[model samples]
Target: MKQVLVFLTDGFADWEASYVCAELNKPNSGYQVKTIAVDLEPKTSMGGLRVLPDYDMSTDLALLDIPMLIVPGGTGWSDPINVQAKELIQHCFEREAGVAAICDATTFLGRHGFLEQHNHTSNSLPDLKLGAPNYSGDEHYVEAQAVVDRQLITANGSAAVEFTKLILEKLNVYQGEVLEQWYGIFKNGIISA
Candidate 1:
């Protein structure tokens, strides 16, 4: 099973990763979702859930071993102490691993120039520019729920379902009508018999 790393930090917006993590973590999904943090310490979500990370930054992982890195939005990204998280993200990117970021985490990526070259989206174009002062991807920014450019997947804060769809598509976990049905079920609560 391929490893899908989800970056977790204190004050993370837990719900942003809910659908994708749940789908990726299923037994038949052929993927293992593990939470990573700067340390082994338990991190609290914005929703008040405390999560004990499975791995820390110093833990050695094989190059390109990760298929994707899921980053959720949160106020924690505002904490300078978590800047070390950038290394893990850079490592994943260096290995060509898909990077999925949503909400303010998108801002974090924008601030770091990750979104500058990729077609991406966030909570708002103006908000992204405001949060990421150095962001220069205005032309690449798409006004949509989510945008996937190559291995990079980005979405707005309210587009968890859309975000999951793109992430699954990039991972090749689901395709065609099956993917759309899954989207319908979660996005619209319309499960077919």
Candidate 2:
């Protein structure tokens, strides 16, 4: 199965990547979710959840060539840290793989100039501008639940549901009517009516 990597770090918003990982874990989802951190150790999330990374940044990350990369927002991403994670994201982009980021995680792409010509949305544009030097795509910013520009997907923290929907759609896990129904049921509890 193709793998989807979720970046793990201290202070991560546990809820942001939960839905994506859950859906990807389905038998026929065609992908599996793995977590990566600077080291193969446990990290505590903002919601007090502990997660152990499946891959170590220093050793296994450069060798990982996956299609989808999911990055959840947290305090950690507010700074220009995690060079290894950033490099891995760049590599994934060069491979034309899908990169999804939510909330503060968008700053990672911003800092790396990935959002330069792509439409994106973050928790706060002003915050992102203050956090990243290469954030020069303000005019392309959209005020939506989620935005998908080619292989790059970005959303604000409040748009986790929409973000999950887009990621699933991009991965071809859900499509057309199936995707709409899934969104309606998950977003509005309108499974039937």
Candidate 3:
């Protein structure tokens, strides 16, 4: 079973994070989903919803050896806890783990020097400089969705529901009827069996 790790923090975007997990957890999807947080207790979402984390950051993610990591955006970017979160992200990058960050969290990738010369985007471009081939769009999410350059895969924001769908596609879950079903859901906002 392939595993996906969601890096959760206080004020994380609930819709983007939870929706991705829920979609990937579909029956026969072959993905094992887990949420990791800086703390062990439940964390509050930007919408004030509480989300229970499956593990703490201190826990060795090596056991699961996740193939992907999803980072959802929120005010947590400015919090001090982001320091450690950034380190973990760097570690994942070093290990060749596929990473996706939505909204402001995308800035974290820029800050860590991980996106140099790679096309990328964030909710708001920060002053922190990077040399990546970045682009920003007006849409809530970049329609092109996940841009895979080498080992890096990035999505602009939540506007592109296809972001997670691309991950599933890469994992070999979004094929044939599954791909069609995902497209229908994106176009009509409904999922059919």
| Total clashing pairs for each candidate | 0, 0, 2
For model 3, the superposed segments whose C-alpha errors exceed 4 Å read 124-146, 158-160, 190-193
lDDT by residue for model 1 (1-193), tens: 7889999989999999999999898988889899999999999999999999999988886743799999999989989988888898888788889999999999999989888778999999999999999999999999999999988999999999999999988888899999999999999999988
Clashing pairs for model 1 are none
- Among the numbered candidates, top TM-score falls to 1
Q: What TM-score would each prediction reach against the true structure?
A: 0.97, 0.93, 0.80
Clashing residue pairs in candidate 2 (N, C-alpha, C atoms within 3 angstroms): none
Residue 130 lDDT, candidate 3, scale 0-100: 37
RMSD of 1: 1.1
Global local distance difference test of model 2: 0.86
Summed over model 3, clashes come to: 2
lDDT of 3 by residue, 51-89 (tens): 898878788767778788888877787687766787678
**Ranking of predictions according to lDDT:** 1, 2, 3
Off by over 4 Å in 1: none
